[model samples]
Target: MGKEFRCGYGKFEVKKMLKNYLLFGLVALFAGLSLRAYAADDKFYSAEQKIVELKEEFNLPSLSVAIGLNNRLAFARAVGYSDIEKDLEANTDTQYSVGSLSKPMTGLAVARLVATGKLDLRQPVSDYLERPQYTSKFSIAKLAAHTAGVPHDTPERDLAEFIDVKDHQRPMDAFYVFDKHPLLFEPGTGQHYSSNGYILLSAVIEEASSKGYVDYLSSEVWDRLGMKATELDTSFAGQESEATYYSSVNKEGLHVRSLDKRDRSFLFGGGGFISTPTDLVRMAQATYGVGYLSVEALQALSMPVKLRSGEINEEKYSLGWRVASVKLGKDDKSWLALHHGGVTDNAATAYLLVVPECKASIAFATNYVPGQFWRMRGRITSILKEYIDIQSCDRWSFAQSSVDA
Candidate 1:
């Protein structure tokens, strides 16, 4: 259901709106709307209409979004072409590569292992394997928080090279990309975003569980959540439900050009996964609402980066998610936000936002990433907020430290 806004019935464009308008009046009636009084142009669009608008505006080949409220998937929808040239329309199950969002899965996997006493955040990761030459040692917690001083990439090796890895890069093999480089700082001394750090985390997970990264996750998380459509960003092509990846949608003369064939497994624990909006929401529920994380476990994942010098990292990053204070709706009050955004070398993008206060979570995904994904993100968020009626946050508290930290 959607909120009531002032709009003229005659001015509603049937072609642009999603679904048939056959029962628009009846639907409005149930939604507590009487469109008799307001002007035409002042009308607010529903989530469906706005999804179409965002797809068109950003030239997204395919887009999907889902909302989880009160521990259930309340809304899920997808639109546009999964393959523009093939004209394959995307459905709610279509999977798009959600880059860095893989971090939380890794984080949760670590938490699961910790719960079983198979992993320890405070221990040196070197306990699992021999420390690589030139790399300063760091604990698992620091690595997850990006405070391990791991460099993003080795010198003379741009991250794009790793991003475009076409070879079957195993999590351990991926270490060569940054293991030889020096740390950005001493471990636990500072914060720096590092995809390579996740590579290390994956290695630790592998050692602790004695299982493959995807295998461990499947058995522990996805299977438990019924997220059957989620999987690693493998090199194998032609998966039935995976959306076509596009590096660029159009050029001067060509219409749909520049496909991106990436084997993102090099960054497996950090940025290697394709998932649907529905699956992402499923993940949000398990990670935040379900009995999956104990109080202390959730505290570990949400704990803000506190440097060795005692200064809080301004990014407010935790093990796998970002912790922040967000002011929602039209109110001036602030709410706790646990969230992450994903971008895959301009090929795809995704974002998942959790408003704990409302027990509400929203996920957005697209196959083709534009230069302005946030603009599309903002528009879709506004539309979904109205659709789900998330106007305030009262069920708010950090699993870790207070906002004042």
Candidate 2:
């Protein structure tokens, strides 16, 4: 009877051990499959792939892009030819005219002055300059927001030549083109895309800072951001490492020629600066990241201004930036984005978008092909959104833990 009881107990123990081993094996297999799935989900587009795609799709002579995450540059790539004639390859350090994208940098300069009590956003431009020909209560804030009732470039006028005198040696000299022109509407009554308004802002910056416009921007904005490669687009002649501008308008549609004729100094605060994609990304990260600008100053630079009638500005022009909500992915909710773009006559285009919610920023530049700014932005934003989504994935956390382990 004792032997029979012992045999039955042993049989029960063997069955229990077999069941336990099967369960453990299943669990191990499931975990391995889960890890593989997570790694697949973590896959992201490489910078090289993105630039190559953009270059092919746009037929761009040269394209550059940079992405910033957590206030640091995460990716930068340049593809195609800087100068097709010279067979020079574009690179992250290659400089291109950033066009109206210069406004944000100018806006930052203003914010710095506001932070230091050197300038007032609410004060009238008349306060800084001598009595002007056109009398109106146009404030510095309105100028920055493009709501100061200034007219845009007129088709009949060659303001570029008039403003670019002496090869843009004097940025304030641009004011001569529109200083006497009458305001298009009452100040604060409406918004207009006015490069001339920024020219006026540049004048005010000079007066308040007691420094040359470019000099102030260099010391206060570029130097502070550690943007060593950025500088005003003064001239193409004798400029080294600068991408030779091109256009697609020639006879063969592929006959790329230098389009660096315009004196960008005339654009001044509006569009005179030239920089690499990485440098622009660095600037965006610094401006939008904490500890760079005061909370109040950032608000002034990012918040959309209201008209005198309390109506919201339709363009969403917030100081130098265009504030709007961008839908990042097909299923994701729209996210607020502070962005700007610049298109120049020399076929140079620049676009910058900063997603403050994700602490992500992207800047892109093309040496040729203006007017496709939004398309380029969409592609870059999509890549960034995918990366951000991957970072937010639970699998990413697990993967990071494993890496840490």
Candidate 3:
């Protein structure tokens, strides 16, 4: 009886071991299939396919995009025609006017000066300007952050007149357009988005650096970032490689038109820069990472303006950037993103989004300017997040190292 019992127990143990082996094999097979599915989803072609669909849906004349991963530019693609009439294909090298994206570049220029002790954020801008026209105390930081209570836009009549002028190139020249306007409210008590404020900043940069705004940006920011293809958006008279501007004028999508006739000189430090997607991504990574501005200066660049009651500004205007939080995917958490977008009335539209959490950035520009372009921008972000993985880092500690000499 003891021998029979031992034999039965041994058989039971053998069956149990076989069941365990089968379960392990099934798990391994399932895991391999999951990985393959993930790999297929992550393919770059997936993004390209979406872009093609967007291009067709939007009826865009041209679209250029660059994606940066881990502080490195990982992908760039341009589609459609730069000049539809000539059938010139837009490529990665094509340059498009990056509207308000110029603001962050201007902000970076200011930060560079602050880093070298050439300018003070808290110092009154009147100290730097020769005329001293502001009625209330307005600091350089306030101007950079658009919290100086300056009017948001130049008077429509004045802007129209300025746009007609042919040769206004100096930053001070642009100042005449809005210098007569009174402050909308007490400086530092309110927040307003004023391109006029940045126009004044260009003058301040010139006065503080003893350099033309264009030359200073070219030398200090563009050259330093290796952005060889970037240049101020100017008259297209001699610009052969610049993308032709297109706008939707009726139910018909996309009509070719002359670029906005506004004198780029007057646009100055406001919204007058043209760049390729690759160059923009490079600039974003350089500014967000070490080697450009000190950590303190970067912090200042990112610090939101405050009202008199110590309440944060609603717009979240930090120097030249818009600081915000973005959710990457449904299951993923939201993260801080620094971004800016530009849209010319008759020309092109551009967007730059940088996520420090992932050390990734994406820049996009299109020759077409349809009212629905903003919707397309959202779709681009959604498609990109599908492939990009967000990685966490100790942001405070990383920022501290940038400040170290």
Candidate 4:
């Protein structure tokens, strides 16, 4: 009976069903494509518009920018107030803390020592600290990568013990915290973002290379790269022309202050270095070429690490960078992009994709609200992703474009 009815059904009924199905499929396909294309085109823009929009949106009192296209300055702009209280404007000369972006410079210091055969990246921290068995498993490499099982910060017990006992006359020596606390885990077994790790490595560099962290940073990294305005600890109290940092207020606006007055002594090599945005972009570009690290060392600087979760993800820390890739598209059509961010208690900063081949680089820095440098970085990063082409910002292509044009 069923077979007979099916056979009796008109060809029109079958044709109508097929037509509806095909139409539905086509609509779904087009909708998917449209959504994807919108997401991709939605994120990119000319640098000028993005700069204008960001300043207005953030109510940035002042901002300074220097763009390197093909590793050369294609454009440089400064707008708003560097000092709102004094009615001062920020310029390329205005210095901002690159914050933990300083980590990469620390990494370069380590790499420079390695280049000169003065230190080994794989050597154990115990080799230099005189405690081989306890930290034997942790290497110089793990410290730079932040995978050495150190705490995210110096231990709280140490902070409570040390904060008031010694004032300026006593001098700052926060490295003592590591001496008091036990290792969090066996080094290299997991990855954690640790300021303490870099601090310890600072000591290690001092011991291994026989140069203090600041001296090594100057002679080997900053001065060599021609980062003239950059300094360690010199700008802690505030400067005449630099923009004062502001912390964000949850209910309304930003509360501003000076990074110079903050207790920056505790930061040491991990997060203490200060620099302007222009100086940052210049020195950072040096790492991309043979003038700095060898190609192998540069690759090592971006190598990804495994975390405690056992996931093989890209966001792992490498020498001085957080090695992660981003995609701008909803599907596989997007390009892979790399990014990193940094912050001090009074400021936040970032360095994004450098296509050394394009000779283009995108770097940014912002003053934190009165007490919110920590949160400002995430906010700034979110703001940046809205406009940045994580792939196209590469410097090499910018260079080639300059010549071709």
The parts of candidate 2 lying over 4 Å away from their true place are 1-45, 155-159, 162-165, 236-238, 249-253, 329-332, 370-373, 389-405
CA shift of 114, model 2, Å: 1.3
Looking at model 3, residue 179 earns an lDDT score of 74
* Number of the predicted model whose TM-score against the real structure is largest: 1
Better of 1 and 3 by TM-score: 1
Q: Model 2 over residues 224-260: C-alpha lDDT tens digits? A: 8878888877654328778887766566557467543
The true-versus-predicted C-alpha distance at residue 265 of model 3, in Å, is: 2.8
Report the error of model 4 at residue 226, Å: 1.7
Write out the backbone clash pairs for model 3: none
lDDT of 2: 0.71
Write down the lDDT of every candidate, Cα atoms only.
0.70, 0.71, 0.73, 0.56
Q: List the candidates ranked by lDDT, beginning with the highest.
A: 3, 2, 1, 4
Worst 10 residues of 3 by lDDT: 396-405
15-61: candidate 1 lDDT, tens digit per residue: 53534443565576688775642212122335666666676667666
Strongest candidate by lDDT? 3
Instruction: Tell how far residue 26 is off in model 3, in angstroms.
Output: 25
**In model 4, what is the error at residue 405, expressed in angstroms?**
44
Q: Between prediction 1 and prediction 3, which has the larger lDDT? A: 3
Clashing pairs in 1: none
Query: Per-residue lDDT tens digits of candidate 4, residues 1-405?
Result: 322122212244345645765575577678775754444333332343355445555555555555544445544556555665565666667777666777777777877777777777778878887642356767777767766777765555245334443322111255565656666876656666777677777777778778776777888888887677776544233365456766543454544454333444455567666666666666667656565776545555555544445543234666676654444435554332234556655354544444343334556665543333244334434444454454554432212100000
The C-alpha local distance difference test score for the whole of candidate 4 amounts to 0.56
